[model samples]
Target: MFYKYETHLHTSEVSLCGHSTGAEMVRAYKRAGYTGIFVTDHFFNGNCTISRKLDWEKQVELLVRGYEKAKAEGKRLGMDVFFGWEYTHNPYGADYLTYNLDKEFLLAYPQLCRLSFKEYSKLVRKNGGLLVHAHPYRTAFYIHYPPNPKVHLVDGVEVNNAGAGSSCNNNHMAWKLARKNPRLIRISGSDIHSTEGAGLAGVAFRYRIKSSRHFVDALRAGDAYLIIDGKITDQEGNPVKEVV
Candidate 1:
């Protein structure tokens, strides 16, 4: 059996742009035939709804509510739940999906939003986590410059962004970029902000991914494939023409 999981998602509890609550999102993924999901709501610096005026501790508390709710539901339903956050690089709209890190880590390093990719890489490595550049080719609305985060700073790249289509996200360009760089693992995400966003993309593994660690390892080992348009596809957007 294959294990399918949504690598990126947002919940209304934390993300101001998200249209569904954490529990609602969880149930949605489950009903859509996913085995798991990563609750990657926006962090304090990004499209978060939380007030920055609050103290750092308070901010972390509110920032994790969505993940916490999803985790609780996941446990009750026997679904795999993982915790991560989509952190935006300050002044740029480019985001990174952080995995294998916990809430305590965020509370301890409240200044994560200010760190450069180099610094962020060091910190994430020290904690044994994976940093994936989310929608690396996306252009910021306020900033005219396109995002070009260094590849060495990230363990993976989102090659197939669900939010990206013909006019938006450079998924085709992103696929070519990752295809050339052998070191960077390729990934896909729905970047789900609403119910309509669910079921657009994810990752599928031949082995059961029992935890966040397994998910990270599977990605690094190139043991996962992209799920798009309700079917498995190659990183270059070609249909596999065979079911997993």
Candidate 2:
């Protein structure tokens, strides 16, 4: 049987762009047949709701509240919830989905938001974290700068982002980039800000992923299947095995 998991999700408690609470998202994903989900709320540079005036420690605590709440609900409902955050690169509005790191890591990096994307990426990889570029070719009004696909810096590239319903995210371009790189990991995400479209896209595995770190390992090893447009497929979006 195949196990499904959502890689990108936001909660109202942490992200200003989010519409649902952590518990609500957890319950929604559970109802949609997701075995697990990674709560990837917006980080400091993004649309996070936490106050920067608070100490770094305090910010870290508040930053994880959404994940903590989702994890608690997931535990109660027999679902796995992992922690992650989306670091937004300013001017360009390029967002990176970071995983495997914990609250302790956030506490240690008080200058997290101050560092450049390349510097922060090195630090994250040094500390055993993974970064995936999300929607690299997305052209939106808020994105003042051009696409900076730091393909070398990121561990993976999200070729498909279902967040923009009708708007074009130029997913085809992302796929081309991944194809050209060959070494870069390929992923898909619903980028669910609300429960209305929670299960439209994600990744699936032949086996259940145990932790956030394990999820990263699976992606790095190319063991996870991409779920695009409600179909399970490989990185190239080919038809794949069924869940039974």
Candidate 3:
């Protein structure tokens, strides 16, 4: 059986752009038949709901509210909930889906928002977390600068984003980028901010992921299948055998 997991998600409690609560998100993904989901809320450098006025400790606490709520609800429903966050490099709006890191990591990095992609990448990899460049070619009014993958600084690239209005996110370009840079890990995610897009895309594995750490290792080992537009495929978007 293939265990499906949503690698990118946001909760209303943590993301200003999110339209659903963490508990609501858990229920939605569970209903959509996902085995697990990562609560990748927008970080302090992004559109996070947490007030910047708070102390570092308080900011960290607020940042995890969504994941904690989802975890609680997921436990009640037997769905695995993992913690993650979307870190944004402002102005250009380059976002990264960061995994395998914990609350303690955030607490330790008081200068996190100030660090450049290169510095952040070094720190995250040194600490066992993997950073996946999200929607590299996306263009929006808020994105004041051109697309900057910062390819060398990322461990992976999100090749498909199946959220609403995904056309604007330019999955094709992301796919092309991943193809050109074979060293970068390839992943797909729903980028769901509400129930309407829950489980629209994900990564599937033959083995169940035990934790966020396991997820990082599994993805790096290329033990993942991409789920995009309701079909299963390999990282290169080629057809793959689907199993229940």
Model 3 per-residue lDDT tens digits across residues 1-244? 6889998999999999999998999999899889999999999989899888899999999999999999999999999999999999886678899999999999999899999878989999899999999888777766765754678899999998885443454888898899889999999998888888677789999999999989988998999999887677888788687754
lDDT ranking, best first: 2, 3, 1
Q: Candidate 2's residue-wise lDDT over 1-244, tens digit each?
A: 7889998899999999899999999999898888999999999889999999999999999999999999999999999999999999896788999999999999888999999988999999999999999888887776765655778999899888987642254888888888999988988998888899878789999999998879988888889898887778877889786855
Query: Residue by residue across 1-244, what tens digits does model 1's lDDT show?
Result: 5677899999999999999988888888888878889999998878899998999999999988998898898878777878899977666667889999887898889878788767988998789889998887876474343555678888899888888662254887787778878788888899998877577689888778887888888887878878876677665556675443
In the predicted model 3, the residue pairs found to clash are none
Estimate every model's Cα lDDT from 0 to 1: 0.82, 0.89, 0.88
Worst 10 residues of 1 by lDDT: 139-148
Q: How displaced is residue 230 in candidate 2, in Å?
A: 1.7
Candidate 2 Cα errors over 4 Å, as ranges? 165-169
| Candidate 1 stretches greater than 4 Å from native | 166-169, 234-238, 241-244
Q: In model 3, which regions exceed 4 Å deviation?
A: 164-169
